[model samples]
Target: MTNTTQTGFALDEADRETFRRQGFLTFKVLEEEEMTRAWRTERLALMDRSNAVYTEEWAVSGNTNISNYDRHLDNDFLADLITDRRITDRVASVLGPDVLCWRTEFFPKYPGDEGTDWHQADTFANASGKPQILWPQNSDFGGTLTVWTAFTEATVDNGCLQFIPGSYTSMNYDETKVMEYRPDGINRNRKEGGVRRGFFGYDYRELQIDPDFVPDESQAVPIVLRPGEAVMFWSTLMHASYPHSGKTEDMRLGFAGRYVPTSVHVYPDTDVVEEYGGKVSLDRYGAVVVSGENRYDHNRIATRTTTGHPFRAH
Candidate 1:
């Protein structure tokens, strides 16, 4: 990796080559002790969503995945976390200098919780039914870059991420296909390998282009991470996680920050986000420019957090 004065953590040619071939890269982003301490304290603060951007009665009504979306827009620590140079610098090296952090979400898996279903996202319409982001017609890429950070120990027995190398070049599921959302289905599906998995409340297999197709688990690699470590990957990469085996009482938490070039239009032609069996107004939604400048005005940009903390670009 190359660390220049201008590019804080930019990847070198060899590093970039590896990322392109594997579709994912793992690196240390923050001090382990500091990250654990911060998460312990911030976890309590995040419970209060009174100042969140999406604070509609329905949005805050339950503990749905939608409720965990975009906390960086409300919390000061999260706001800084999304714009941290350790992340954006490496992201910009692959996605170009001009980038926007359009969304962030917290993924938590408690003991006995089901693992996530194997999935790949391009337009991100698998759940919402409407495309959340749109790339230019001539662009070569369609999906955003995702930086997922572990806020706690991520072990195989406690729900660590799994990936299929080089699976990002082609998509296996059709995003336009509709999937039924059955809340009761959570933790109920036992797949071919007898692994319990589900996608929030929806069945990701319903969107498969080939009904009989199955992911080659033989080639899947588990990503074990220490607290404060992060992995960056293409959103189109085939990825999933193992179930928390109840071997330990500790819950595994991951924070994901999604990034894209300024040319992309986020939440195109929509002012509301409806997914995960809940709907929320996007009146206060704005993408943060983490590095370089956003030359396009197609997306709303947030210069500061909801708590009035300014977002500094790398």
Candidate 2:
């Protein structure tokens, strides 16, 4: 494994080759004890979202997916986590030197919760009907690099992430297609393999380019992780999760920080994010540059958290 003085865990050429072939990589980014302590405090503190960047009345619709969107913009701990060198350095190794963290979200699966539907995100327009991120016309890639950290121990019984290796090269679903968000539809659908799954409230199958195309579950691999461990993968990879079997009372939580090159335009032609039965204004939204300098002037950049904590880039 090759390591750089600046980036202690930078991916070696072989590592990059593996990621290119498999479309995902797993690594340890945070200490278990530190993450446990920090999450214990931060989870309670996050309850008071009085200073959150997305504070519109509709943004707080209870239990909606939008409720936990972009907390890194206000929470100091999350801000530091997103810009952590361990993550950004590896992300930069794959996506190039200049990288921006455009989004962060909390994925919590309580006992008895359904698994996320098998899906791939390119432009991220499946449910919102608007392209959330737009790559340059000549670019070869189309999706963000999502670094998903397990804030809580993730087991197959508790909805651990599942992925189809080497499934990132081509998109099976069309992002341009619209998916109806029916809040009442949660936990109601089972796919071909009888895996109880749904994408929040929307059925990801609605966006499938070939409605008859069912994901090959035989090739799916479950990723069980200890708390503080993380896996970074292309957003276009075929990924899902196992349903929480109600075997454990503790909820499984995954924190995802999404990164893209500076050349990409985040939230292109929009000031609001509408999805999952709620809408939020982007008035206070800005992409945080986590590595290298951003030479593009297209996206709004945030140098500090809403609470005045500066983001320290690698």
Candidate 3:
């Protein structure tokens, strides 16, 4: 990775290539005290008791889960981070000047909270029935690059994310099946004897991490980052969050935002968009364009307000 001190921080070249080839890059210990404090303050101010944004299918009232959590971008601090120039500029370097923030969501893996199972995000790919962009093949035309920022120090014990390096290059696993998942607000059941599949808690044990071949053990890396440090991985990368086994009470509070070249198709099928009113725009989950691209044609900003506040300064 290319490492150079810029504006008092550094971005290594090797890390940049890791992001391009492997579909992920982790910048460890990059946040300053000021940035961290600002995020903490804004997050604390944004916390509230509610669970609405999540579909009724995935709504559960509990301190552990924040449903349909979005809209905090209005908070200056949080918005700054989501659209941070250092982050977005790097993304621009890859996807070109024309790009948009397609998605944003928080994955809080708390103590005693069983972690999400190993899965790929490809299910969201074929949703539009159109051909979803594939990596390696489309490396020239980059797709969604998700940045996972840690609100609190993320250690392996507290359920930091795990990833299979370079796995995005293959389509070894079928992502179309809607598997049964009963974690937090997301719960679904299949018909008797009906085959349930999808990236959920159900198939954690059955699927081979790599059925075709043995992977380089050295390449399967687990990332443990400090608060303010972020891990940027592709949407198609094979990744999963492990259970919280750390001694701390704080959850692995992370906010993920997907940035893709404006050229890629958003939602592929009518099945999802018809049920969910959101058009396949860059503002999925109200992800505003902090920078780059102006693909959002419809003026529906007012309707993108998010319910509840689960990310305020403590």
Candidate 4:
């Protein structure tokens, strides 16, 4: 595992203790024409959300459930793939050298959709109830370090990302427990083992502090990416996915990119993020250091990229 590689890609020494006891990590950062030119400039920047930093929420006025969260502060190939250094130098080698790529979303399952539920997120507050990230009152635990990536070929029939390995220090769903946004309960519940997950319409087992727990899917796994591949996990980890199975007509499309460690607190007293039912307004949000130097001025950073692209830190 101490098999190394450098000049911009990292993690060796037994893959950094196997990513500090398996929070997660996959490879191949991007190729295949940089995932077909970042999915053709993210489908022409999602049909012009007019410089989107998340204007309309559930994406298309159609509701495939909704996520265009930060769009890397208005896309410059997702702001240089969210400060790429093979993902901010392997998440600044597990969060240290001043990292900070505060959010960037866009999941998109499609075809028959539904899958993403298991959930974990340390203070993402499950989904915007508050505390989008705090970490460091002497730090016992903090989460964000996502990265996701595969904007196209994921495949376990179309959904992909599953995880569970070491279960990242276990929180078992309870980001201060909230969960209840039912945009008509998205693909209609369906999970007493029939599978077809759901979180976009919120049912992450209803904030499961333990309402009959359950998620030992034989220690899950399936991450299968290909078009530009990428993984890096631990948004608290346990994760979930796998329901697309419309037998394929191309849809998977992940693209996360969270990160943290500029001494945390990206959205402390948040300004309007709500959740799947839709809301959004951290009012021109910022946070994009991406590697070092941001020695704590609390938050709101953003150096260059409302469309200019100079996030360059790593």
- Best by the lDDT measure: 1
For every model shown, what is its TM-score relative to the native structure?
0.95, 0.95, 0.68, 0.31
Question: Model 3 reaches what TM-score against the true structure?
Answer: 0.68
Evaluation by TM-score, superior candidate among 1 and 4:
1
Candidate 4 lDDT over residue span 81-147, tens digit each: 8877777877788787888888777888888877888888888877667787889899978888898
Name the TM-score of candidate 2.
Answer: 0.95
Clashes of 2: 0
lDDT values for all models: 0.90, 0.88, 0.53, 0.76
TM-score winner between 2 and 3, please give it.
Answer: 2
Model 2, 1-314: lDDT tens digits are: 64777566789888899899999999988899989998999999899787787776564565478878888877888988998988988999999899999999999999989999899999988889999999999998899999999999999999999999999999999888888878897877565478789898888899889989989989999999998999999999999999999997999999999999999999998888888888888887889988999999999998873445343222
> Alpha carbon lDDT of residue 225, candidate 4?
80
lDDT, residue 168, candidate 4: 83
Model 3 accuracy (lDDT, Cα): 0.53
Q: What are the per-residue Cα lDDT tens digits for candidate 3 across 45-104? A: 666324223333323223223243443434445555666766776666666676556556
Better of 3 and 4 by TM-score: 3
